[model samples]
Target: MPAFSVMGEFEVIQRYFANSGRARKDTLIGVGDDGAVLQLREGYDLVVTTDTMVAGTHFFPDVDPRALGHKLVAVNISDLAAMGAEPAWLSLAMTLPKVEDPWLAAFADAFSETADYYDCQLVGGDTTRGPMTFTVVAKGQVPHGKMLTRRGAKVGDFIYVTGTLGDAGLGLRLCQGQVEVSKKHSAHILQRFHYPTARLAIGQALRTVASSAMDLSDGLYSDIQHLMHRSAVGASLDIERLPLSQALKDSCDRSTALALALSGGEDYELLFTVPESKKSMLDVLLSPYGVPVTCIGRITGAAGKLELRAGNEPFAYEHRGFEHFEK
Candidate 1:
């Protein structure tokens, strides 16, 4: 049997989360207070985002505590990155079945490490006994009038995405025993699922160049559709131009790989549009960042029309992206 903590909520917070090391200079009041106080930078706009990860819904119950902690913070930061903002501070609200010291220690360590890596400080949070879930509220900053959004794509803009897609969805399948891959390729795909790297640098680089942008959390098909809806434009994606990783290509057949790339979620890559005139500069500007940016489509004048074409022929795909309430 696992040992449970007898400490009260305040003691738990003090023991695990109230460390001064997690506090940033901008944080006037961190953990243990009723609320956190932070000083925002001058001439910058604040971007706040929150994401929840629930046991069974968002992750397996037996998942590593460290990876879960990392993901809990990462997904929230990805939203800030989508807006070309620099992550500044975060608050966590965690609901655990019970308090186990060793488990809490591992989770807190990993969580702090990830926050520190992004230069984000933990300001305030709450802990409670309930189903296992985590809600992270993250705040970031962008220069005044330069925050990216999903409402600026134009008819002649070029659509591009950073990094390859579908590996995480494949990784999920491998974890669930629905598919199999060679031992050599399993680790790469699995890591892609469990440890997604937010495209922060790419987002920061495209602040001035991208007309509209969003992080790919709900797969390219659904996410780009959202961007189109927001921008009031249409698009035509070339099926052959979609990027795929070697592990994905080798693990599945061409059609299956393409399907995953189209509708697979949780890749956490950035999808943005640049004006046709700036196309030449896009690659050159992002080349120094070392993240692959591939132009997959073009915005069109036909509003609400999104088509996937394969060399001038219209292609059909039945599966849409993940929906929270699908029957």
Candidate 2:
């Protein structure tokens, strides 16, 4: 009889998860190659998304490791949310400077909590020794015939968003020590920056109704610009209609606060457009989801044009939100 031997990493993975739940009818190939093969589920479209966060660029060096871990996972979940998909699985690839037990413990605890909350599980991942960086690839499932896209917006659609805008942007400003955080608003701003809840439920609920949707990871202005460009339509957002957190307004004036809400980044809220007829139904349906849906603008018939209305007059923004290379 031959002695039994243990398999290596690749072999072990193949033996276990090769044909597992992660590989359903939608999966053409599960393992054993440089890349896995997948097919769009029949009647059901696939929604795939990826996000990366570097130590210095996306996050602070000395911040809470647990929150960082949760955010790394949650933000990616937000992308799936934007597509109105039910998150099914995720793969994590992490680069670490060193494996510190306490840090890993906290990070794993937070990661598990977040994944569990969203009913997502980690099916595949890899670890490497290097500077701190984390990347996630999340897979989501939507109804067979419905998946929201950025290019589907039609003129006269009502532009809406989940939750208040600009909190994360305000949080970042406070984090950088640029803006002073009042005693009353300090915790709110810090919490907004440390942990952002992805509007997963709202996204799913809007699938059949929303024409276009995206997460505001950058800022409302830039991300909306993306939606407008993809849809081949222009938009005019009413500044007065933009939602603001009481904490944010308490810290700054109306103009500055509005600008921050418009152009500040890292909000991770869902910006979606729905038909005017769907408004009342959406409002009643989404009330229990613990997220607010606010209509801030409307899509235009014209193409390649964007407008912003501040009070009675239009205002020109100096910058169109955050850009990586621009600064």
Candidate 3:
């Protein structure tokens, strides 16, 4: 193997990340500074969220650097989206096993691309040598008193989800070789897993409409339970109403697809509730965005109880979703 020189911390930052992304007007001080100075728009409240992804846990150890970079930023932005905030700035703390210039370049390029696409600027961060891990801190802005929260759902609200579900979960299984799919289907599923899209537009649009909201990171079953718990309400979900991509349906049986949709995590789609009074206006309001929104359930008065039904028959689910500390 050819010998490679390890880049010092400052050298790595200047070479790969200092000038990697576009500048933002709100960023008073950006990369290369001790800390970022940001200008918050008047009447807007800041929303900040952080997420960490570790190799062999959140992703495969051999995952492409570019995809990893995109996912690192996307997941954090998803949190902002769920709160009806517009992504504005990002900070990344990354740990790598080695300092490979080519790998770092690819990662930074994709990371910068993702930031620019979302109109977010990379303000500041740190790097170190350790296991392959990424911690992204994202900042967003939402109009005062308009941000959605997980605690706002009320009884008689309608539960809805943006975009299709379960593709990413199936994609993970395909990557691990636990399931078989055709080449075309595999490509789509893998893309879903590798480049999960944050539903930022839908979230922003629903700020005034949604009663409660959250991004689906821990599978619908687990995430919806979170919303119910936070809002002190119950839900009655229609399993038949869950959305599945054509690719997912083609790759798995109905039962298998439904199971994946329920328990598969990391979809990053928005799961929200809207008052029944506003249901008639949903189509008119959301049609312009072109994102598919499905009403999957209804909020109930029974706090903390979630029921699943399939065509009027009670349904039972075995898997609750991915739990980090399950014994």
TM-score of each: 0.95, 0.85, 0.95
TM-score of 1: 0.95
lDDT of 2 by residue, 1-327 (tens): 121133244543344334333334544554445565655445666678999888877877676888987897789899999988888677766677766667766776777677767876656655666688888898888877688889999999999987888888888877776788799989988888789998888888888689999999778887898999999999988888898999988988887788788888888899989888887788777978877778998999878678888767898777655543222
Task: Write the residue-wise lDDT of candidate 1 on 67-110 in tens digits.
Answer: 98888788888889899999989888878888888988888888
Please, what is the whole-model Cα lDDT of each candidate in the order they appear? 0.86, 0.78, 0.89
Residue clash pairs of candidate 3: none
Off by over 4 Å in 2: 1-43, 320-327
Q: Considering TM-score, where higher is better, how would the candidates rank from best to worst?
A: 3, 1, 2
For candidate 3, write residues 1-327 as lDDT tens digits. 122236665566777887555688889988776788999999999999999988888887778999998999899999999999999999988788898778889999999999888899988887787888889999999999999999999999999999999999898888777789888788889999999999999999898789999999889998898999999999999999999999999999998899789988889999999998888888888999989999999999999998999979999878756542222
**Backbone atom clashes (below 3 Å) for every candidate:** 0, 2, 0
Question: What is the lDDT for 115 in model 2?
Answer: 75
- Model 1 stretches astray by more than 4 angstroms: 1-6, 20-22, 322-327
